[model samples]
Target: MSMDTRNLLVELFVEELPPKALKKIGDAFAQTLYATLQSQGLLEKDSMLTPFASPRRLGVHITNVADQADDKQVSQKLMPVSVGLDANGKATPALLKKLNALGADESAVANLKRESDGKAEALFFHSVVQGATLAEGLQKALEDTLVKLPIPKVMTYQLADGWDTVNFVRPAHGLIALYGNDIIPVSVLGLKAGTTTHGHRFEAGLDPVFIRHADTYAEQLVKEGAVIAGFAERRAEIVRQLQEAAANAGDNLKPIDDEALLDEVTGLVERPNVVIGQFEETFLDVPQECLILTMKANQKYFPLLDADGKLTNKFLIVSNIRPADASAVIGGNERVVRPRLADAKFFFDQDRKKKLESRVEGLAKVVYHNKLGTQGERIERVRAIAKAIAAKLGVDAKQVDSAAQLAKADLLTDMVGEFPELQGIMGRYYALHDGLPADVADAIEDHYKPRFAGDELPRNAVGTVVALADKLETLVGLFSIGQVPTGDKDPFALRRHALGVIRMLVEGKLAIGIDELIAAAEQPFGKITAEHRDALLNFIFDRLANTLREQGYSAQEIDAVLALRPQRLADVAERLAAVRAFAALPEAESLAAANKRVANILKKVEGEVAAKVDTSLLKEDAEAALNNTLSTVKPQADAAFDRGDYTASLQALAALKTPVDAFFDGVMVNADDTALRNNRLGLLATLHAAMNRVADISRLAS
Candidate 1:
C-alpha cells in the first residue's frame, strides 16, 4: 500500500574514502539500493530517497517502503498434450513423472487444463506464488548491493574472526539496517547488522551514537555525534562561511568558485570550520594565475580576490576540527602556504632573466612524440605552415612566423617545467619582457585557443594564423603514422584539433580552403601519401557535420549543403541557410524531384555528354522552352552566386520551375535518334550545373 509504507535506512561504516571519488561512490551506493528494493516489488512507485556521505560512511534513507510484496498467479507449462495423454484421453507415464517434479501427483492432472500453444496443445498448471517477507527480501538485497557498488579501488583485509577475508572499497567496520525503529537482520562484508554506528573520530561527543529511529539519523548524528551527516547540507554550510569571510575582508573581494575543490574539501571534513590566512604581499609580484594555481592545487585553499578580481594575500581554509581558540589553526595554515608561494615567485623570477627567444634552441632536446620527432622540429613545421597560410590570406608573413617560432619556447622555462599548464601563458609574459611587438606577444599566448569545446578563438589575425598552423601540424603528423582516433580513444586529441580548426575557419569567416591548408601542412612532412591526406580531410568534415548537427541543424539541410563538397568553409553556414530557405518554398519538392531524375539519367550515360546543344535538333516545344528559360535564368543565378548572395542565387532558380516541369512531362530523354539524345543530355547537364552552384538542391528531395 502506497499510503501505509514505512521509512527504511541503511548505512555502511568504513575507513576514510578517497576524497575525489567519495561523492560518486555515495551516490552510486544509494541509487543501487533503491533500485534493488524497487525491483523486488517492496517499494511504491513514488518513494523518495535521501543520500548521506561523509569521510567515513555512506548511508541512505528511503520513504514509503513495504513490509512484504503482493502475491501473484503464475502459469507453468507442464508438457505437450501428446506426451501427457494417451489416445483415449487418459493419463500416460510421462504425465505422472512431470507432475512429481512440481510437487503434484496423478490427482492434480485431472484439474490441469489443455491449451493450444502455437502449433501444438500444451497442458498448463496454474498456481499462486507466495509474497516475500521483509526479512527474506532484505537479506538478498543487502548482499547484492555491496557487490554492485562502483568501488574505485578495493582492499582485502582479514575479518575479526581471523579465518575469513573480504574485499571492499575500504575496510568495513559496521553496517546498519532499520525498518522503522526495529533492526532488520542483515549481514554483509563479514559484518553483522546493528542499530548503532560510530561518528567523527575526534569531534563526536559520544563514542557510539545510538540510532533510536531510522528517521532521526541526521539529527542524532549532529546532536550526539557532532557530525553533519548529510553531504549536501555540509557543502552548503561551507559555502555560506566562505561567502561571509570574503565579505568581511573589504570591498570588491570574493572567493573563487571551484565546484571540484568544494566537493573534495567537503569529503575531507565532517565538522567544517572556515579560517582566514594571509601571505606576504610581495608574492603578488608573480602572475596571479601562478599564485592561484599553487594555492588551490598544492594547499587546497580558496584564494580571495579584490574589486578588480585580482588575487589578494588573504585566503580561506576549511579545517575539520573547530577549536575554541582559532589562532593556532590560522597560524599553521599561513606557515604552510608561504613556501608554496615562495617557490612560485622563485620560478617566475628565474624564468624572466632569460629572453623567450633565447630558449628556442633548448627545445631540440625535448621529445614531442616518438614518431613526430622533437619539439624543435615540430616548431619548424608549424612556422613553415603558418607562413604558407599567411601568403594565401594576404597577412604579414613576418608576424605569423615570429609567433610560431616562439609558441613552443616556453616549454623550456622553469615556471612551465614545474607546471606544464603554464606553457603558453608564460611565453606571453616573457615575450612582453623582451620588448617584442604586442601582436606577436599576444599571439604567443593565444596559439592554444579553443582548447576545448565552446572555448573562445584567437583575438587577432596573427594569433589565428598560428593557432590554425599548430592544430593542423598535430593532426597531419599524427594521421600520417596511422594513429587516427577510433571509438573513444583519441589519446593525442586529434578530434579536438580538428574541431578547433573548423571553429576558426567558420567563426572567423576565414577565406582559407581546408584542402589548401592540408596541402600546406603536408608539405612540411615531405613524402606523405595521398591516402593519408584524404583520410584527414574526411575526418575534418565528419567533425564539422557532427558539430553542425549539435547546433540544431537538420540532417537533410546538412546533407544538401555538404553534398556539394564546398572548399571554402566560411560559406558553409550561408549555404546551409540557403538550403533551408529553398526547402520551405512551395515549388521546392517538384524541382527537387526533377533534379533527382536528371541526376539518375546522367549517371546511366556511358560517355561524357557533349557541351554544345544543336538548336535545330530540338523538335518538341518543351525542349525548346526549357532551353530558352535556361538562357535567361542561368546568368542571373550565376551573378547572384558570384556576389556571395546565396539566398538570392537559390531564389533565382524558382522562375525556371514551370519550364522544367513542362519539359519532363512532354519529352522522353532516351530517344532512338543518336543526335537528338546527345543534345537532350547536354541540356540536362546545363540545368544540373546551374542548380548545384550554391548547394546540391536534389538532396532536399524526399
Candidate 2:
C-alpha cells in the first residue's frame, strides 16, 4: 500500500427519474459503488464520499481513491498429497494434469509446497496476483451497481446501432468516470465514459459542461451548467426560498410543513426558483384540507397558511427556470391549480346537497370485501359493537349508534370518492351540514383517528366508542374469514387497527373488557367467529405486548402482566407499573424465586389444590411462620389490589420474603403424611394466588 491517492468522480446522465425514489437511488448508488471499491482495495480508510441526485442524473464524488490496489500473495490448492505424489514422492499423472489446468506443467512440481489441510496433507501452488487497475475495478463496480439497483420499474431502450438494448430505471444517455484529471474509461448502460454531460436541460449556461478534474465536478456543473448538482444543497435552497416567500406574505404566516412534498419537489428540478401564486378567494369556501391536498398532490404546490393556520388563496411553487419577467410563471401555475381547486369546490358543494344520512343507503351497494359482505352490513356490526361498548361506558347508546351508522357514509360522497384520504373528514362536514349534533359529527371523523403510529386519539367519549367498534369489527370479521395477517402481509392493515384499539382502551382509561368486546363484535359473524374467536383475541393481545415492548417496557414485565390475561384493558398499564416497582424492591429476587418454586411444586400435583390450609397440619416452625405471615400480609395486599393501587399491592407482598425463604429452606412440601402434604399444597396455592394479583412476579425470577 502507498500514500498516493486521487479524487474520483462518476456520473450517469439519464431521463427524468421518479421523484419519490430519487433520494434512495442516489444513496444506494454512492454507497454500493464505494463499498465495491473499498472491497477491491482502491479506496483509503479516510476517504470521503458525496452523492448527487437530480431529475436527470445520479453521480458521486470520492476523495483519496487509489489508482490500483496492492498486490497480494495467492494460494491454489492442487490435490491431496497421497493423490499428487507416488510412493517415492515423485509427481503423479493426476498432479501433472491439475498443473496443466492451472497454466503450469510438471516442471513446476519442484516448487509446489506440501501443507496439512485439516488431517490430510495437500499440494499447494503459491503465486503473486497483481492488483486490479482503476479501469478494471470501476467497470466491474459500475456494472454491479446498475444490476443490483432497487429500480421500481426499468425501461428498455436500444443503443445507437439499434441492435442491442439495456434496461435501466430510465435510459441513460451519458457516463462519466474521472480519476484526477484523466478518464477511467469505464462503461455502463451501453454508454461509454466521458468528461462531458448536459445539465438543466432548459437553463444550463453551457450546452455540454466539461469536467477538467475529478474534484471540480460539482463546481463545474453549478458554474458552467447553471445547475445545483447536490440534493441536500438544492433542498436547503428550496426551504430558504419557501421561508422567505412565506415571511414576505405576512407576519406569523408560514408554508405548510410537508417533508415528502419538499423532497419530491427537490428531486423534480435541477435548479429551483420559488414563486408565489394565488387563486381566486371564492374557492377558499371549500374545506381547506380538500384545497391543500389537491394543491400538494396534484400540482406539487406548497399551500400558504395565515397566522391562525388557515389556508389562504396564496401558494408557493418551485420552478426549474427563473425568468426576469416572473408574471408568466406565477400566472401559469395559478391557472393550472384553479381547475384543481374548482374540482375540490364542486365535490364539496355537490356532496353537501345530499346529507350524510341520505348517503347511508349508497353504502349497501359498495362491497367491503368479497368475504365480508358490503359496507352497509359492516356498519350494522360496528353499530352493534358501539352500542355494547357505550352501554359499558354508561354513555348515550343512541348517539353512539347514530355516529357508527353514518361514519362510512362519506365513502359514497363525491369529495371522498375523488380523494379516498378524505373519507372520514368529509363525513364529519356532511354530518354537520345535516344538522347532526357536534359530538356525533365529530365522532364520525374521529373514528379514523390514530390512523398512524404516534397520531392523536379520538377527541371525545363518543368518538372513542365508535373507533373501538370500527376497529373491532375489522379485526373479528377478518379473522373469522381466515384473512389474518401473515408475516409482513397485512393487506387490510390489521396490525394498525389492532394498535388503534389498544391505544384507545389503554389511553382513554376505559374499563371495557377486551373479551366482552371481542365476544360482542363476533356475535354478528355467527359461527365464523365461534371457531376463530380465541385466535382473534390472541392477535389483539400480541399487538398490546408489542406496543409495550416498543414503549421500552422489558419483556419479563410484559409477560408477567399479560400472562394473567386481565379482562379490563385499562388495568394493563397499572399492572405493568406495579411489576416494575416490585422488581426494584430489595426482597423481590428472593420472593420471585420462592414463588417459582411454589408454582413448580403445585403444578406437579395430580389435581387442583384447594386453598384450605389447616393450622394443626403445619408442624414445622418455618411452615408456621409462613402461615402466620400470609395471614398478616394477605389482607394488606388484597386491600391494595381491591382499591386499584397495584404498586401498593405488589409492595405489600415484599414483607413475606423472609418467611417464604424460611419455608422453602426448612419445610418439605411433599410430606410422608397425606394430610400434611395437602395442607402444605394448600398453603403454597394461597401464596401463589396472593402474590399474583398484580402480575406473575415469578417471571422476574433469575
lDDT, model 1, position 665: 91
Model 1: lDDT equals 0.90
10 residues in a row with least lDDT, candidate 1 = 1-10
Q: What TM-score number comes out for model 1?
A: 0.94
Cα lDDT, model 2, residue 278: 92
TM-score of 2: 0.96
TM-scores, all models, native as reference: 0.94, 0.96
lDDT over C-alpha atoms for residue 248 of model 1: 81
Model 1 lDDT per residue over 13-83, tens place: 98998888889888888888888888778898888999999998999999888888777788989789999
Best by lDDT: 2
Taking every candidate in turn, the Cα RMSD to the unseen true structure, in Å, is: 2.5, 2.1
Model 1 lDDT, residue 617, Cα? 96
Please, what is the whole-model Cα lDDT of each candidate in the order they appear? 0.90, 0.91
